[model samples]
Target: MSEDAGRVPAEPPDLRVGHEERAAAMRALDTHFEAGRLDVTEYGERSGVAGTATHRHELEELFTDLPAPHPEFSPAAGPPAVPEKAPDRHPLGHRHTAMALLPLLAVIGIVLLVVVGGQPAGLAFFPIVFLLAGRFGPRRF
Candidate 1:
């Protein structure tokens, strides 16, 4: 009789996984979700599982049905490659930041207009900001 017939296979060298490994697995999951391999709920559930996983096998299970992430995207190796420039760069990369300040700008304008112009000219700014936001808001930028 072969003495090794019943021995179990050994685990891979990647036995313990830290936060970075878990995060890399989640990124792969995200890519799959974006490609429509998984629905929202499935993505959320798997993401939660990946986030809490502490072992390599546990993380592997999350992507068992999906292709492995590219080596550049693998967290186990190192941080993912950063683009030379951001994926989407605005004129100054501050369009969104400026857009976010719209409300505050509107409020300040309203206060100034009401105080200086002695009219509700500030209220007029809302429509302009609203239009600007609609034109350059999340949908596009």
Candidate 2:
């Protein structure tokens, strides 16, 4: 194994930046300008420098006198966390239960519609139940 295998990689001060970083720095400068921390002329100067900055350190230097709301830089450290696996489920799960219940619910709804014999709006209940079941059913993947 390499000697540095166990160490978190250091973020070099002179790391080259891209357009995204420069834009972020400009946004920070705009915020300071709006908060009255920097006058129009100072804002213009700092924004110019930010627009032309080539390295992470150059951007960091722009915020030396400012407070929070700095541009976020990704750390050169450890690997990203692995996602947890989905839980195991039974062969007959929530989706199966829902599928079995839907027809039964429709039958009950039809019976109510026939017995009550008012508005046929009661038939809408079946579709609503079907939608709810599908939405809240267990994951297939």
Candidate 3:
């Protein structure tokens, strides 16, 4: 048999979101909006997350149940859409030398926890030391 025979296949274009999943997400969105927990402007902005026609329709249905769409509404400023890149796009934001101490810190925490768990004051000091070490230590990065 060829190596490619082991590959799992893809679906045809027609299948999108399953109906039940769409309805549930819609219900949660509607409940938040209807409870006065969400204002109309906020609702308009967030409703874009539904990501499909069916999901939007479900929300519109819920809106129909509300008493009135309030007038004099300000259009909500949309939050910026954050663009994503592949993991390798950004170098891990760090100083090269700083990472050297991470293992040491872990060892310190584990040893302190094990050796000092029997003492109340030492146990308390353990976390304080760990936090201070994290702040001022780590090779100045």
Scored by lDDT, the top model is 2
Clash list (residue pairs), candidate 2: none
**Model 2 lDDT on a 0 to 1 scale:** 0.80
Q: What lDDT score belongs to each candidate, Candidate 1 first?
A: 0.71, 0.80, 0.54
Error of 1 at 101 (Å): 60
lDDT string, candidate 1, 73-120, tens digits: 233444568868655555666767777677667667777888888996
TM-score winner among the candidates? 2
> Per-residue CA lDDT of candidate 3, range 55-117, in tens?
233344544544554211122335668898657532754553465466467657666766776
Per-model TM values vs. the true structure:
0.40, 0.48, 0.24
- Better by TM-score, candidate 3 or 1: 1
Distance from true location, Cα of 85 in model 3, Å: 45
Clashing residue pairs, backbone N/CA/C < 3 A, model 3: none
| Candidate 2 lDDT by residue in tens digits, 1-141 | 998999976788998887888988988888988999999988988888889988899999989999998998766546669999877666657667776676567667776786787757776676776665676554477
Error of 2 at 137 (Å): 58
